[model samples]
Target: MIRGVRGAITIQENSEKEIIQATDRLLHKMIDENQIMPEYVASVFISVTDDITDAFPAKVLRSLEGWSYVPVMCMKEISVSNALEKCIRVMMHVNTAKSQQEINHVYLEDAVVLRPDLASK
Candidate 1:
Protein backbone atom coordinates (compact mmCIF):
# COMPACT_ATOMS: atom_id res chain seq x y z
CA MET A 1 0.00 0.00 0.00
CA ILE A 2 1.05 3.57 -0.51
CA ARG A 3 1.00 5.87 2.48
CA GLY A 4 1.80 9.44 3.26
CA VAL A 5 3.72 10.73 6.25
CA ARG A 6 3.37 14.39 7.14
CA GLY A 7 5.64 16.63 9.16
CA ALA A 8 6.11 20.31 9.89
CA ILE A 9 8.60 22.42 11.79
CA THR A 10 9.14 26.07 12.62
CA ILE A 11 12.47 27.85 12.37
CA GLN A 12 13.61 30.68 14.56
CA GLU A 13 15.25 32.51 11.69
CA ASN A 14 15.11 32.77 7.92
CA SER A 15 18.77 32.00 7.30
CA GLU A 16 19.84 29.09 5.11
CA LYS A 17 21.45 27.38 8.09
CA GLU A 18 18.30 27.59 10.19
CA ILE A 19 16.03 26.32 7.41
CA ILE A 20 18.36 23.47 6.57
CA GLN A 21 18.79 22.43 10.18
CA ALA A 22 15.10 22.60 10.99
CA THR A 23 14.12 20.72 7.83
CA ASP A 24 16.66 18.03 8.56
CA ARG A 25 15.36 17.70 12.09
CA LEU A 26 11.75 17.38 10.96
CA LEU A 27 12.55 14.85 8.21
CA HIS A 28 14.69 12.74 10.47
CA LYS A 29 12.02 12.63 13.12
CA MET A 30 9.35 11.70 10.60
CA ILE A 31 11.49 8.94 9.09
CA ASP A 32 12.56 7.55 12.43
CA GLU A 33 9.12 7.62 13.97
CA ASN A 34 7.65 5.72 11.04
CA GLN A 35 10.68 3.49 10.43
CA ILE A 36 10.68 4.51 6.76
CA MET A 37 13.63 3.72 4.54
CA PRO A 38 14.66 5.84 1.61
CA GLU A 39 13.98 3.02 -0.81
CA TYR A 40 10.38 3.01 0.29
CA VAL A 41 9.87 6.68 -0.32
CA ALA A 42 8.25 7.50 -3.68
CA SER A 43 8.45 11.25 -3.42
CA VAL A 44 8.39 14.19 -1.04
CA PHE A 45 6.42 17.41 -1.34
CA ILE A 46 7.58 20.38 0.70
CA SER A 47 6.12 23.80 1.33
CA VAL A 48 7.33 26.77 3.30
CA THR A 49 5.80 29.98 4.50
CA ASP A 50 6.78 33.19 2.70
CA ASP A 51 9.08 34.19 5.52
CA ILE A 52 11.35 31.20 4.85
CA THR A 53 12.68 32.13 1.45
CA ASP A 54 16.33 31.70 2.28
CA ALA A 55 16.52 28.09 1.05
CA PHE A 56 14.44 25.32 -0.45
CA PRO A 57 13.82 22.60 2.09
CA ALA A 58 13.73 19.87 -0.60
CA LYS A 59 17.30 20.71 -1.63
CA VAL A 60 18.57 20.02 1.86
CA LEU A 61 17.44 16.40 1.55
CA ARG A 62 20.00 15.84 -1.19
CA SER A 63 22.71 15.96 1.44
CA LEU A 64 21.31 12.91 3.16
CA GLU A 65 23.10 9.67 2.23
CA GLY A 66 20.18 7.79 0.64
CA TRP A 67 17.98 10.71 -0.27
CA SER A 68 19.70 11.60 -3.52
CA TYR A 69 17.53 9.19 -5.51
CA VAL A 70 14.30 10.34 -3.96
CA PRO A 71 12.15 12.84 -5.87
CA VAL A 72 11.36 16.07 -4.04
CA MET A 73 9.57 19.27 -4.90
CA CYS A 74 9.32 22.51 -2.99
CA MET A 75 6.80 25.31 -3.13
CA LYS A 76 5.80 28.44 -1.28
CA GLU A 77 2.83 28.25 1.04
CA ILE A 78 -0.03 30.68 0.71
CA SER A 79 0.39 33.55 3.13
CA VAL A 80 -2.43 34.19 5.54
CA SER A 81 -2.70 36.99 8.06
CA ASN A 82 -2.82 34.76 11.15
CA ALA A 83 -0.90 31.78 9.74
CA LEU A 84 2.26 30.34 11.22
CA GLU A 85 5.54 31.91 10.21
CA LYS A 86 8.91 30.43 9.23
CA CYS A 87 7.23 27.08 8.88
CA ILE A 88 8.25 24.18 6.63
CA ARG A 89 5.86 21.34 5.92
CA VAL A 90 6.41 18.07 4.10
CA MET A 91 4.32 15.17 2.89
CA MET A 92 6.23 12.03 2.00
CA HIS A 93 4.66 9.38 -0.22
CA VAL A 94 5.98 5.91 0.50
CA ASN A 95 5.29 2.26 -0.25
CA THR A 96 4.48 0.77 3.11
CA ALA A 97 2.82 -2.26 4.63
CA LYS A 98 1.42 -0.21 7.48
CA SER A 99 -2.13 1.03 7.46
CA GLN A 100 -2.95 4.73 7.28
CA GLN A 101 -3.98 4.73 10.91
CA GLU A 102 -0.57 3.41 11.90
CA ILE A 103 1.39 6.13 10.14
CA ASN A 104 3.04 8.65 12.42
CA HIS A 105 2.99 12.35 11.51
CA VAL A 106 5.41 14.74 13.14
CA TYR A 107 5.15 18.40 14.09
CA LEU A 108 7.92 20.21 15.92
CA GLU A 109 8.64 23.48 17.69
CA ASP A 110 6.06 26.17 16.99
CA ALA A 111 4.62 24.16 14.15
CA VAL A 112 3.11 21.77 16.63
CA VAL A 113 0.20 24.12 17.02
CA LEU A 114 -0.68 23.67 13.37
CA ARG A 115 -1.78 20.09 13.94
CA PRO A 116 -2.58 19.63 17.58
CA ASP A 117 -4.54 16.45 16.89
CA LEU A 118 -1.54 14.75 15.33
CA ALA A 119 1.15 16.04 17.66
CA SER A 120 2.87 13.58 19.97
CA LYS A 121 1.58 13.57 23.47
Candidate 2:
Protein backbone atom coordinates (compact mmCIF):
# COMPACT_ATOMS: atom_id res chain seq x y z
CA MET A 1 0.00 0.00 0.00
CA ILE A 2 0.95 3.63 -0.39
CA ARG A 3 0.82 6.22 2.35
CA GLY A 4 1.44 9.93 2.59
CA VAL A 5 3.04 12.05 5.26
CA ARG A 6 2.19 15.69 5.84
CA GLY A 7 4.44 17.97 7.82
CA ALA A 8 4.28 21.73 8.37
CA ILE A 9 6.56 24.31 9.97
CA THR A 10 6.80 28.06 10.25
CA ILE A 11 10.02 29.93 9.69
CA GLN A 12 11.21 32.21 12.46
CA GLU A 13 12.43 34.70 9.92
CA ASN A 14 12.85 35.44 6.24
CA SER A 15 16.55 34.61 6.29
CA GLU A 16 17.62 32.05 3.70
CA LYS A 17 19.68 30.07 6.16
CA GLU A 18 16.93 29.73 8.73
CA ILE A 19 14.35 28.80 6.11
CA ILE A 20 16.61 26.14 4.68
CA GLN A 21 17.58 24.83 8.08
CA ALA A 22 14.05 24.59 9.42
CA THR A 23 12.79 22.85 6.31
CA ASP A 24 15.74 20.51 6.24
CA ARG A 25 15.16 19.59 9.85
CA LEU A 26 11.42 19.08 9.41
CA LEU A 27 11.75 16.93 6.30
CA HIS A 28 14.48 14.79 7.76
CA LYS A 29 12.53 14.31 10.94
CA MET A 30 9.39 13.22 9.11
CA ILE A 31 11.32 10.80 6.93
CA ASP A 32 13.34 9.34 9.77
CA GLU A 33 10.44 9.06 12.21
CA ASN A 34 8.41 7.26 9.58
CA GLN A 35 11.31 5.18 8.22
CA ILE A 36 10.64 6.53 4.73
CA MET A 37 13.24 6.02 2.02
CA PRO A 38 13.95 8.32 -0.87
CA GLU A 39 13.37 5.57 -3.40
CA TYR A 40 9.92 4.94 -2.04
CA VAL A 41 8.92 8.59 -2.16
CA ALA A 42 6.75 9.25 -5.19
CA SER A 43 6.81 12.99 -4.78
CA VAL A 44 7.19 15.75 -2.23
CA PHE A 45 5.15 18.91 -2.48
CA ILE A 46 6.26 21.97 -0.56
CA SER A 47 4.35 25.18 -0.10
CA VAL A 48 5.73 28.30 1.47
CA THR A 49 4.08 31.49 2.55
CA ASP A 50 4.32 34.48 0.23
CA ASP A 51 6.88 36.11 2.47
CA ILE A 52 9.17 33.11 2.08
CA THR A 53 10.34 33.81 -1.43
CA ASP A 54 13.90 34.06 -0.18
CA ALA A 55 14.36 30.36 -0.98
CA PHE A 56 12.48 27.31 -2.01
CA PRO A 57 12.32 24.75 0.76
CA ALA A 58 12.10 21.88 -1.72
CA LYS A 59 15.36 22.88 -3.38
CA VAL A 60 17.07 22.87 -0.02
CA LEU A 61 15.91 19.31 0.54
CA ARG A 62 17.15 18.23 -2.87
CA SER A 63 20.59 19.71 -2.43
CA LEU A 64 21.17 19.41 1.30
CA GLU A 65 20.42 15.69 1.57
CA GLY A 66 21.25 14.53 -1.97
CA TRP A 67 17.61 13.81 -2.74
CA SER A 68 18.18 14.65 -6.39
CA TYR A 69 16.14 11.70 -7.66
CA VAL A 70 13.10 12.32 -5.52
CA PRO A 71 10.54 14.52 -7.28
CA VAL A 72 10.17 17.83 -5.48
CA MET A 73 7.99 20.82 -6.26
CA CYS A 74 7.40 24.21 -4.67
CA MET A 75 4.28 26.31 -4.55
CA LYS A 76 2.82 29.41 -2.91
CA GLU A 77 0.71 28.89 0.13
CA ILE A 78 -2.87 30.11 0.16
CA SER A 79 -3.22 33.59 1.49
CA VAL A 80 -5.83 33.41 4.17
CA SER A 81 -6.77 35.99 6.75
CA ASN A 82 -4.72 35.76 9.92
CA ALA A 83 -2.82 32.81 8.53
CA LEU A 84 0.60 31.92 9.83
CA GLU A 85 3.34 33.85 8.11
CA LYS A 86 6.66 32.46 6.89
CA CYS A 87 5.31 28.96 6.99
CA ILE A 88 6.35 25.93 4.96
CA ARG A 89 4.18 22.91 4.56
CA VAL A 90 5.09 19.60 2.94
CA MET A 91 3.12 16.65 1.68
CA MET A 92 5.20 13.59 0.91
CA HIS A 93 3.75 10.70 -1.01
CA VAL A 94 5.54 7.41 -0.68
CA ASN A 95 4.91 3.74 -1.21
CA THR A 96 4.70 2.24 2.23
CA ALA A 97 3.60 -0.84 4.12
CA LYS A 98 2.13 1.34 6.83
CA SER A 99 -1.18 3.09 7.31
CA GLN A 100 -1.75 6.84 7.20
CA GLN A 101 -2.14 7.16 10.94
CA GLU A 102 1.05 5.20 11.41
CA ILE A 103 2.97 7.83 9.46
CA ASN A 104 4.77 10.39 11.57
CA HIS A 105 3.91 13.91 10.53
CA VAL A 106 6.41 16.41 11.83
CA TYR A 107 5.72 19.92 13.12
CA LEU A 108 8.88 21.63 14.23
CA GLU A 109 9.73 24.92 15.91
CA ASP A 110 6.91 27.42 16.04
CA ALA A 111 4.94 25.28 13.67
CA VAL A 112 4.38 22.89 16.53
CA VAL A 113 1.81 25.30 17.83
CA LEU A 114 -0.32 24.41 14.89
CA ARG A 115 -0.68 20.95 16.31
CA PRO A 116 0.18 21.22 19.96
CA ASP A 117 -1.79 18.11 20.83
CA LEU A 118 0.33 15.88 18.67
CA ALA A 119 3.50 17.83 19.30
CA SER A 120 3.19 17.32 23.03
CA LYS A 121 3.40 13.59 22.53
Candidate 3:
Protein backbone atom coordinates (compact mmCIF):
# COMPACT_ATOMS: atom_id res chain seq x y z
CA MET A 1 0.00 0.00 0.00
CA ILE A 2 1.03 3.61 -0.52
CA ARG A 3 0.49 6.39 2.02
CA GLY A 4 1.28 10.04 2.28
CA VAL A 5 2.80 11.62 5.36
CA ARG A 6 2.37 15.34 5.81
CA GLY A 7 4.44 17.72 7.90
CA ALA A 8 5.07 21.42 8.31
CA ILE A 9 7.43 23.59 10.29
CA THR A 10 8.20 27.28 10.70
CA ILE A 11 11.72 28.57 10.27
CA GLN A 12 13.27 31.38 12.25
CA GLU A 13 14.86 33.03 9.24
CA ASN A 14 15.44 32.86 5.51
CA SER A 15 19.07 31.84 5.75
CA GLU A 16 20.13 28.58 4.16
CA LYS A 17 21.34 27.29 7.49
CA GLU A 18 18.03 27.96 9.17
CA ILE A 19 16.04 26.41 6.33
CA ILE A 20 18.24 23.32 6.35
CA GLN A 21 17.93 22.96 10.12
CA ALA A 22 14.18 23.34 10.14
CA THR A 23 13.70 21.01 7.20
CA ASP A 24 15.96 18.43 8.79
CA ARG A 25 14.08 18.60 12.04
CA LEU A 26 10.67 18.29 10.45
CA LEU A 27 11.70 15.41 8.15
CA HIS A 28 13.37 13.53 10.96
CA LYS A 29 10.31 13.84 13.14
CA MET A 30 8.01 12.69 10.38
CA ILE A 31 10.20 9.71 9.51
CA ASP A 32 10.57 8.70 13.13
CA GLU A 33 6.91 9.14 14.02
CA ASN A 34 5.81 7.20 10.98
CA GLN A 35 8.49 4.53 11.39
CA ILE A 36 9.44 5.17 7.78
CA MET A 37 12.49 3.62 6.17
CA PRO A 38 14.33 5.59 3.50
CA GLU A 39 13.97 2.75 1.02
CA TYR A 40 10.22 2.83 1.44
CA VAL A 41 9.91 6.48 0.49
CA ALA A 42 8.68 6.83 -3.07
CA SER A 43 9.07 10.57 -3.28
CA VAL A 44 8.84 13.78 -1.35
CA PHE A 45 7.28 17.09 -2.36
CA ILE A 46 8.05 20.19 -0.33
CA SER A 47 6.86 23.76 -0.47
CA VAL A 48 7.97 26.88 1.27
CA THR A 49 6.21 30.18 1.80
CA ASP A 50 7.26 32.90 -0.63
CA ASP A 51 9.17 34.67 2.07
CA ILE A 52 11.58 31.79 2.25
CA THR A 53 13.89 32.13 -0.78
CA ASP A 54 17.24 31.29 0.69
CA ALA A 55 17.11 27.54 0.27
CA PHE A 56 15.32 24.57 -1.19
CA PRO A 57 14.21 22.10 1.43
CA ALA A 58 14.73 19.20 -0.91
CA LYS A 59 18.41 20.03 -1.28
CA VAL A 60 18.87 19.44 2.42
CA LEU A 61 17.35 16.03 2.10
CA ARG A 62 20.19 15.00 -0.20
CA SER A 63 22.58 15.45 2.70
CA LEU A 64 20.89 12.64 4.58
CA GLU A 65 22.86 9.43 4.46
CA GLY A 66 20.26 7.14 2.96
CA TRP A 67 18.01 9.64 1.18
CA SER A 68 20.13 10.14 -1.93
CA TYR A 69 18.02 7.70 -3.90
CA VAL A 70 14.70 9.15 -2.82
CA PRO A 71 13.05 11.40 -5.37
CA VAL A 72 12.43 14.88 -3.98
CA MET A 73 11.33 18.26 -5.21
CA CYS A 74 10.77 21.67 -3.70
CA MET A 75 8.64 24.56 -4.82
CA LYS A 76 7.31 27.89 -3.59
CA GLU A 77 3.99 27.97 -1.85
CA ILE A 78 1.18 30.23 -2.97
CA SER A 79 1.28 33.44 -1.03
CA VAL A 80 -1.93 34.25 0.74
CA SER A 81 -2.93 36.95 3.15
CA ASN A 82 -2.80 35.91 6.81
CA ALA A 83 -0.83 32.80 5.90
CA LEU A 84 1.99 31.58 8.05
CA GLU A 85 5.42 32.99 7.20
CA LYS A 86 8.75 31.19 6.88
CA CYS A 87 6.78 28.00 6.69
CA ILE A 88 7.89 24.81 4.94
CA ARG A 89 5.53 21.97 4.20
CA VAL A 90 6.21 18.47 2.99
CA MET A 91 4.24 15.52 1.70
CA MET A 92 6.03 12.23 1.46
CA HIS A 93 4.78 9.24 -0.53
CA VAL A 94 5.81 5.98 0.98
CA ASN A 95 5.12 2.33 0.46
CA THR A 96 3.72 1.32 3.79
CA ALA A 97 1.29 -1.18 5.18
CA LYS A 98 -0.46 1.42 7.35
CA SER A 99 -3.80 2.92 6.47
CA GLN A 100 -4.33 6.67 6.08
CA GLN A 101 -5.77 6.99 9.58
CA GLU A 102 -2.72 5.19 10.94
CA ILE A 103 -0.35 7.85 9.57
CA ASN A 104 0.83 10.70 11.75
CA HIS A 105 0.83 14.25 10.44
CA VAL A 106 3.29 16.62 12.05
CA TYR A 107 2.90 20.38 12.49
CA LEU A 108 5.58 22.17 14.42
CA GLU A 109 6.35 25.63 15.76
CA ASP A 110 4.08 28.42 14.52
CA ALA A 111 2.90 26.17 11.73
CA VAL A 112 0.90 24.34 14.38
CA VAL A 113 -1.69 27.07 14.00
CA LEU A 114 -2.24 25.97 10.42
CA ARG A 115 -3.56 22.60 11.52
CA PRO A 116 -4.88 22.63 15.02
CA ASP A 117 -6.71 19.38 14.39
CA LEU A 118 -3.44 17.54 13.81
CA ALA A 119 -1.31 19.37 16.33
CA SER A 120 0.59 17.10 18.68
CA LYS A 121 -0.38 17.21 22.30
User: TM per model?
Assistant: 0.95, 0.90, 0.95
What is the lDDT for 15 in model 3?
98
Error of 2 at 83 (Å): 0.8
TM-score of 2: 0.90
Model 3: number of backbone collisions? 0
lDDT by residue for model 2 (1-99), tens: 777788888877898898889888888888889888788889899999889978878877788455789999999988999888888999999899887
Q: Candidate 3, after superposition: displacement of residue 74 in Å? A: 0.4
Model 1 residue runs over 4 Å out of place are none
The TM-score-based order of candidates, best leading, equals 1, 3, 2
lDDT of 1 by residue, 50-80 (tens): 8888888887788888889999999999989
- Put the candidates in lDDT order, highest first: 3, 1, 2
